[model samples]
Target chain A: MIILNQSKLNPSNIQPSEITSREVFENRRHFLKAAGFGLAAGSALLLSKQSQAAIAPVTFKANSRQKISGFSKTAYGAGEKLTQYEDVTTYNNYYEFGTGKSDPAIQATLFKPRPWTISIEGQVKKAKTISIEDLLKLAPLEERIYRMRCVEAWSMVIPWVGLPLASLVKWAEPTGNAKYIEFISESDPQSMPGVRSPILDWPYTEGLRMDEATNPLTLLAVGLYGEYLPNQNGAPVRLVTPWKYGFKGGKAIVKIRFVEKMPLTTWYKAGPSEYGFYANVNPNVDHPRWTQSSEKPIGAGLFGGRIKTKMFNGYSEQVAHMYTGMDLNRNF
Target chain B: MKKQHIVFVKAAIWLFALLPLARLIWLGVNDNLGANPIEFIEHSTGTWALVFLLITLGMTPIRLLTGQVWQIQLRRVLGLFMFFYACLHIITYVWLDFVFMWDELLIDVAKHPRILVGFAAFLLAIPLAATSNSYMIKRLKTNWKKLHQAVYLIAILAVVHFWMLVKKDLTEPIYYAVVLIVLLGIRVYFKYKPLSKSKVIKAM
Candidate 1:
């Protein structure tokens, strides 16, 4: 465990000359108004760097003693430390770069991230855009190792670095009428090969019900494995909802629209019967072709039998209240 | 034909048919088939079975159009190979994917429309393969022709199965559909077309 020196790190050095010159500042403000500052402290994390003023130096946790099935635990700094051996982090699903998991890591290297800004509008009372640089400065990064389960029945435990979605939601300040938040990725077919296919709408879209976004489990993941997320895994930034399937965690997110009703998701739109928008990871809810009772853990032997899936991906304490009396089988 | 030549040719054909089965066994042993090996194995065997089915179906039309009588005999071998691969495919899915989860399998077959179609195709292929042997053919000579009619139904169902499984990539399934359509079209035309007096062969 490495201790951080908060005295040495300052936001004055990291903050860009102007955060509102681009549209991202407006986006954050728009989201704040829509979500309606639920918790003041977390919301403060989303305001300008001047709020804290003093930067907290990052505390590094060496994963030398960590073991995940067949993989070795390595230090993954919140936004800087990453393991990039071609066979590892580079091969993944960062849908903004492409649909194939490995495509984003391989092709997203061509993307210039310095000018990135997100547009937040729709039903929000305060609509404003903000730059990506200012967004990172709002919160100090920390790591959490979470299990990611794909619809295809494979699982991976990733060390994600970012802030909770609640924090951003608080800053966005949801209005009384805002019922859901719709996330959209940039739609540039020339850069994203997966969008070229008619399988899903060109610009991928996902949504979280208003209550879900307020859940602490919802994360605004900026990086993984101690380094900036590889292009294949939603580089720059993405959302990670631990209780849901991987696809529900939209990658390479560009737009955040708070609306009065639930947003239409790409997968659900492509085949409604096959991919339900709720996309909760439930063992009882089987895929059309395959059963969801078990999952083949990634990094395990290819021939190994799958392990049984737990309810709500083992986050029943935090999320079970949301589903309270609903039948997961029917909702699934 | 010389006995040695016949033995060698028979061995070669048997070996050729077993090649895919051997490859599956090798991959299963080495654990190299990837995350969802059951799906991969099931798909590989099912694809090869379709290829063989298409080949067997083509022999009749090809022989009729080209006046090649020798090709008709190979049809039996090709049909049997198709059944052989199909058995491997189904067994893999049942034994590995479902793991003898009969109740769950039943529910799956009931819920998924595509599974029902695939199951129907698999059932139809069974009788056609069972009657391929000389003993079964001789015992049911009059009925053999009627039973073999199931192949046409199986071919159609197989194409439907392929089309439904693919999400967006249609290239491979489209290729199979095209071949099946041509083979099926020729059969239908031959059966229904009117023959002229000059073209009709006189029976001795």
Candidate 2:
């Protein structure tokens, strides 16, 4: 067993300015230039290498389809560490690609996300099939770091760059009769092999109440981590409802329909007993197979540990009013 | 069977049975168990448990077909491995996954049918594992056969537990189900055939 000399490593002996000065060496160029003429060059190089390894810059492949700019530098929060871009893209549950967590990253490479069109129809005053470019021009995108909680009791903090869903809903000019907005995902069996199997009904569908759809927190994400969304992560565009479970965020959206009644969601239709239409992240309410009280954050290594799940995934302040007076247990 | 052959077979079975546990340790030490290691460990142990259960079930049919009584010795070894893996699976869930939060675990078991079924199957395997030794086998005699027959029921419950655990894509579960059905079918066919033949002979 190894024991540390606690007296020598005491925090009281460390000066605040010394700590701040040490942080200044975080810049590799500064460290290199300062050490260029000194005998401390070797140790400086070693320190720089160590720091560089700790904060290795993530590289995102550029997509020609992505054009939204001026939204990359925005930081949503400093508290929660963002789930690694690699994990965010590679570990996914986009069933259209495949059911395995890693399958989407592999199979979705063949998926054609560009030249995509989303048809806005059903009870909308302006019903049109718009190209992705035209949709991008509709509104300016902003980076929002949101906590995504999956029903499987895993969670991630993703920095998503997107326009608010409310802007798109407003542009559609829904008729007075529209009560719900249904989002449909692309599902060509030739492309999405997972669709061939009856794992879920083809053309995965998800819906939100009109009020929920127009909520400021609801985003139509086009990019993640200052880059175009990876094919595995819904590519060109996808829904991002921070308060609800991840499945509610329909991937690779193909169609948006304004309806007078609640739409049949894929998971809810598959197993209503397990997946309810309103999949709000409620810690008090447990899933049929697992408890929702806690979540293991992905990319947080083997024993990276778990945190207590919050109601509405810690967005209760923003979304709790939407379900006021309604029994969450019953809705769940 | 020759004493040497029995020793060789036992050594091979031991290595084969311990492979999954060894692989898990390697993966854990190498930090290659992926995002959710607890889940990975749980799933790996559970699957091995089911695989061993199926292998144990298959032994009887193979013995019947080949007229090898030595296969019966292998069956006990395989059954013990099945129980061992099942214990690991449960221990992983209780100690690592839930962190010994008994209240939450109890609530989860009560709420989830799959967890309840899996726990029940593990509970049933306890008696069989305990009586696998020669001492208990001789003590119980005919009743031991009846007690160990619960493995068939355990197999069904294990399959259902796996089926319910997955969110979608029943391909893996379906494969397990098919293997189990074939094994059970073979046992049923052999079991009734001798009875029917004896009945015909008695009638004549």
Q: Report the number of the highest-lDDT candidate.
A: 2
By DockQ thresholds, what CAPRI class is model 2?
A: medium
What would the C-alpha RMSD of candidate 2 be, to one decimal place? Answer: 9.3
- Model 1 chain A: weakest 10-residue lDDT segment is A63-72
Model 1: per-residue lDDT, tens digit, B13-120? 678878988998899787556445666688889999898899889988875566555557667888889998888878876776666777766876776667888889
- Candidate 1 lDDT score at position A11: 47
- Per-model chain A TM: 0.73, 0.80
Instruction: Specify the highest-DockQ model's number.
Output: 2
Model 2 residue runs over 4 Å out of place are: A1-69, A72-75, B194-204
Model 1 gets an lDDT of 0.69
How well does candidate 2 match the true structure in TM-score terms? 0.84
lDDT of 1 by residue, A175-239 (tens): 88889999998777777666666656768899999889878778787765545555566656789
Cα lDDT tens digits, model 2, B1-204, are: 898999899999999999999999999997677666788899999999999999999887775565556777788999999999999999988877877778777888998899999999999999999999999999999999999899999999999999999887888999999999999997787677867664553454
For model 2 chain A, the run of ten residues with the poorest summed lDDT: A49-58
